[model samples]
Target: MSALRVNNLAISLDGFATGDGQSLEAPFGHAGERLHEWYVSTRFFHAQDGLPGGTLGVDNAFAEQHEQGFGAEIMGAGKFGPPNWQDDPDWKGWWGPNPPFHTPVFVVTHRPRPSIEMDGGTTYHFVDAAPSEVLEQARQAADGADVRLGGGPTVVREFLTAGLVDYMHVAQVPILLGRGVRLWDGLESLEDAFDIEVVSSPSGVTHLTFVAKPR
Candidate 1:
């Protein structure tokens, strides 16, 4: 069976995945780009834009894994766009016409919109469903490939709570966001279920990989 995987998810030392007051201008909210600085400097990120000259190290190595071994992706509505993006019928997503994911992408939202196909192989399918339901949709579209669980913290928490994730990679950034959406809340003792391996990058980011223990 294909695994449900999460990769390159950045969070602060305070455990906030995203800050408060999310807007079209501030996608990561008050947290700004602090969470993703490590990834932005990676060669994998630069390569995505057809650019060159980015850090070639441990951070890049982990960042590069985000696009591999996945045929479908499931993301929360917040990750798809800013607040109330559902209000705008014309809103496609934070990414322009050619979004990054070159696979079927499922957007989990209370307000489902018609599916949107873009320049790349990426196609956004809006669905209003539970975590399991959305996972099923993504798995079906995945065609035996693994499904990537792209998150906005809340959705990640939902799937985590449901015990659906098979693998996850979190980049722990060193910062303190006093108030924001946290990733570890209500997930006490989650480490017991997975075999976690931790690595500290020279870039001051900690890479944590979790693989579910066989039941």
Candidate 2:
């Protein structure tokens, strides 16, 4: 079976994945671009923007993996847009006409909408379903390739709780936002289910990998 993986998920030392006050103006909320500073500094990010001149180092290595071996993606509605995005019929997503996914992307939301096909081969399909059911949908869409578990903290937490994730790569940034949406809430003692590996980078962001152990 194809694996369900999460790549380049950034979180703060305080365990917050995203900050408060999420809106169109503040996509990452009050957290802003702080959580993703490690990623945006990479050569991988520069290449994605069709630019040049970015650091090609340890951070770049992990950042590049985000686009590899994934045929489909499942993201939460929060990741798809700001709060109450369903209310805005005109809202497409944070990404413009050409999204980076380049695959069938499923948006798990309470309100399902008509699918939107973008310029790059990325198509957004909104579905009102549970994590397991959505994973199955993404798996089928992925065919023989792996499925990418794209996320907001809430969605990732649900999948982690459901044991639906096979592998996860989290970039632990050093900053701390005392108030925000945390990633580790209600997920106590989760290390037992997955073998964890921690690698620190010169950029002060520690890379943590979690791979599910065999049953």
Candidate 3:
């Protein structure tokens, strides 16, 4: 069946999904880019952005799997672009012309904007609806395929806390940001059940996949 999956979400050693003070200069927060070192060095990311070349190994394999696993993607306002709201309606996104995600993308934002058409099949839909409502719309857009939760911490936390996420893949990096946006911030309790089905890639990056068991 269709599942709400979070694939290749990076987290720091300190459990921070994003560093503090997110802006255009620091997209993933101050030191958040460090968490995604594994991804940026992979051939999957290079090929996605039409780069020349990159390494091919376990990192590449994981990157490829993560990229291909999702039919549609959901991002929070913070992940899509700058945190501050703008009055202008023409701001497309951080991606200038083409974005990496060539599939339907639903962005959860308080401000409403018309759907953006990119060079590839990628289209960004700004939804002012609640998280559950947006997820339903994303499911429809996914066409029976898995929906990926791509985010800026808050979104993932929401889905997790709501018990909507079926599976999650976290790439734990070795670095630590003392103060930043944490991944497990809003979780009500540590007793919540999540079964770790797979854990591997201990060398370059630590990959862990967990399946949320029904309570």
For every model shown, what is its TM-score relative to the native structure?
0.97, 0.98, 0.89
**Model 2 C-alpha lDDT per residue in residues 1-215, reported as the tens digit of each score:** 79999999999999999998999899889999999988998999998788897878889999999989999999999999989989999999999999989999999999999999999899999999989999999999999899999888889999999998999999999998888899999999999899999999999999999999985
The lDDT leader among the candidates is 1
Tens digits of lDDT, candidate 1, 1-215 = 98999999999998999999999999999999999999999899898779999999999999989988999999998899989999999999988898889999999999998899998899999999989999999999999999999998999999999999999999999999998899999999999989999999999999999999886
Better of 2 and 3 by TM-score: 2
lDDT (0 to 1) per candidate:
0.94, 0.93, 0.81
Better of 2 and 3 by lDDT: 2
Model 3 CA deviation exceeding 4 Å by range: 50-53, 188-191, 197-204
* Local accuracy of candidate 3 as per-residue lDDT tens digits, 2-104: 8888888888878888888887788877885688878888888888768978778776777787766577899988888877745556678888788877889
Candidate 2 runs further than 4 Å off? none
Q: Which candidate do you rate higher for TM-score, 1 or 3?
A: 1
Each candidate: RMSD:
0.9, 0.8, 2.1
Instruction: Output the lDDT of residue 15, model 2.
Output: 94
**Residue-pair clashes per candidate, as listed?**
0, 0, 0
Q: Which candidate wins on TM-score?
A: 2
- By lDDT, rank the candidates, best first: 1, 2, 3
TM-score computed on alpha carbons, candidate 2: 0.98
Candidate 3 — number of clashing residue pairs? 0
